[model samples]
Every structure is written in structure tokens, then in C-alpha cells.
Target: MPTTLPVGDVTSNGRTWRQSYAEDFTKPAALGTVASVYPGMGLYDGFQDTSGLGTYAPAKVLSVADGNLDFDFHSEDGRPLVAAVMPDGYAPHTTARVSIRYKTTVTDGYKFVGMLWPSSDEWNDGEIDWPESLTLGASPRPASAIPGTYANRHVKYDRSVQVHAKTDTTEYHVATTEWDTGIVRFYWDGELVSCTTEAVPTKPMRVTLQGETWTDHGAVPTDASGTVSVDWISIWN
Candidate 1:
């Protein structure tokens, strides 16, 4: 893969996109210290208290080597281990595009999610998840959620309009999400797989790459382990 970022502006769907952030992971480092490794990104570490799942131990679960950012997930003390990371400063964009070239080892009890999370940190605003799937036995899909009133309480309603990709996680693929006014599109290998106007987020959002146990789909086996490698990532606005 090319170690350098794409040189000029990228034109897609008649829109000119200027690259805002890019990472090739050519310099070897640990993602746990992302501030020093990649300057404009932050790592989610420490025991996760709210999610009721495994710990986010970046040092143990994430690294950079061989020109890729790698996520190594395993069971620790019967609890799942995982990592999450995102870019800082240049985020919370009302309209943006993100593309990630990545592949993974297909393990039974692990999953990955690439998402645009609301900058407001409120579920009521919106969320966009793309290239999300279990590490095994599933294809990548684009999903979205919006908050609404339920039983006199505000709750998120997952309006995941399924846009499936035929590719599996073991093969390298470029997953892209384009967010514009009143619309969101998901593409796999430059082919538009899904588009949705429902619950399109209008507020600024930030990109997050998260790897976690597939608890929502099934119970994680005690011996589950896997690796997810991101060859590179580019953001445009």
C-alpha cells in the first residue's frame, strides 16, 4: 500500500473533497500513547464503567506496526478486551466524509464498528455507524440511530437501514461514509451499497473506530481472540 497520503483533491459524485486528516501508520508506535504517536488522536483506555463490558486497555489491545494500526482483542480474566480511538480537533463536522482501509482476523466473538458520533454526546442528536459487523459470519453494514420519546422517556431508535457488503472482514476493503445535508451514504470499495435520509444527523459529529466483544449478538467465548488492522484512514470535509 502507498505510504503517502493522496496528493490532490478528490472528486466524487460531483463534489470536490479536500483531505483534512490522514494516517498511514508508517512509523511504529503504540496507540495507547496516541497523542505522541499520532498527535491529533486520543485513545480510550482504562476500565469501562458505563458499558458493562470489557476494559478499554489501549496498551494491551492496540499497536502500530508494519504500516498499520492493529487491534488485538482477547479475553482477560473472563472479560473481553478491546480498544477505541478517534481524531481530535477536526471533528464534529456537520458534513464530512471518512474512509478507512482495513482488514481483520475472523474470530468468533469479536466485532468492529466505525461510526460518526454526535459531538453533543447526546443520543438524541444522532449517530451514524458504517462498516459494522461481527468478526465472523456477517457482512459489513451501515446503520443509524435517532432518539425519540418512548414510554415517557427519551430512547434511541435504531433506524439501521441495512446496506450490506458481500466482502468479509478477512479481506482488505475500503469502507466509506458520506454525510451531507439530509442524506448519508455508505460505500464499499467505491460502490454505493446503502443510502438513507431517515434520521440523518444534522449536528456535528466525530469519527470513532471501536473494537469490542460481540456481546450484543452472542456471548463471547472465554478464549476469543482476534486482530483488526487498519491500513490507513482519510477524512474529508
Candidate 2:
């Protein structure tokens, strides 16, 4: 996601939070964030690293029909690929919410959509990883790798509330992370899934959504490609 002001405004709790950035992928030119694609993994506020071992293809806006646009993230060589956007400003220390609606085509790879501190070296710094999963069940897998299970996490001060909850990934689901001074909560389809207060982030962070062919060791065998679709994303503070 781009680091700039959103194009619209949303009012919540008597306070108005602007739409720092949004993409339906209806028009590529209209996309506000930097795009992270193959060969080059830098853009859209994403980190740049070596390619092939585990890299991402650039995010594209596919047109399904007239006036209908959807954001697409796919990998050509079965490598990791991602399409992400960052919000314009720091989240309010008092309260804030970051939410997105998305779905995947296959269960062979890893897909993570959530929030994290932009500059933190470790993911445990004030992070909210909802709808985060390792579906393929790596060779030396974690207990959460069951077919019908999904891993959702909340991190603060390096401590995390990592839980495996049963869910269907083929269908679209709404995932959100809400936080304030007391605690951070994870939600799926409007229901609370997990909550933690240990390592809640205090600094500002950015939103990231990525789809990759991965495992505990390396890339796993799967289709030549996979995709993750985003219907919409919103933030309030």
C-alpha cells in the first residue's frame, strides 16, 4: 500500500477517518500504492530481497467485465507473490481497526493479510495477523496445519496469541483486527476469534497482504500459479 492520504472518508464513533488508500483494481493507473512484482520485489512499501528462492509477482488489476474490477496476486514460477497497500498515517493509540475481505483459489500455499509495524525487524512488534495461514502442512509442520484449520495471530512486545481455528478458505471471509489501550482482538465474519494484550504494538504500522508458495523449509509443490483476491479494505482511527 502507498504511504499517503486516502481518497475518501469514513466516520466511526463520531470521528471521521479518511480513506488513506483504496483499490478495486478497476483501473491500474488509479491504484494509489506502489506495486511489488517479479524480478523486482520493491514497491508499494514492501521490502526488497533476493528473487526466485521466494519472490512475489507484481500485483495486477484484472477486469472481469465492464465497470467491475478486482485486485489480483499471482505467481508465475510457483514462487511467492504479493499485492499490499499501506495507510497514510499512524494509527491512533487510543483505537483503530484494519479490515479486508478476500479469498484464495487453492490451499497449497501461504496467504497472510494483516497489520504490522513497518520498521520492526521482528513480526511480534505490535502486529495483528488475521486470516493468516499455512495450509499446505509443511514437512516439519506446526500443529495448526490441519486441512480445515486457519492460524490467526496477535503480537505485541514479541509475545503472540497464535491460535488455530477451523475455517473454509475457498469462500470469501471478512477478517479484521481491532485494538485500543487495553487489548487487541481478531475477528472473522464479525465474530471474535482471539484476543491478546501482552505485545500490543504502540508504534504506527502498515497493512500487508501477500500470497506465496512456501513451507517451513522451502517452496512446496503446487499449481504453476495461485491467486488471492481482494474485494475491499478499510481503516478507521
State which candidate has the highest lDDT. 1
Runs with alpha carbons beyond 4 Å of true place in candidate 1 = 1-7, 30-35, 49-51, 88-90, 147-160
lDDT measured at residue 51 in model 1 versus the true structure, 0 to 100: 40
**Per-residue lDDT of model 2, residues 1-237, tens digit only:** 222223566554355664444544343333333332121122342343222344543434222222222334344555445444443333333356666666665546454444544344344343555666664221110011111122354222322356554565566666766665556777676666667765456655555554444445455454434545555666665
RMSD of each: 2.8, 8.5
TM-score of each: 0.88, 0.62
Cα misplacement distance, residue 32 of candidate 1 (Å):
4.8
lDDT of 1 by residue, 1-237 (tens): 333455456787778988788878888886455557776776777866224567788878888889889888987788888888895543668788888888888788878888898888877778888889855436888887763322344555445568679877788888889987778888988889888877688888889998877755556788878898898888888
**Model 2 TM-score (2 dp):** 0.62
Give per-residue lDDT, candidate 2, residue 207: 56
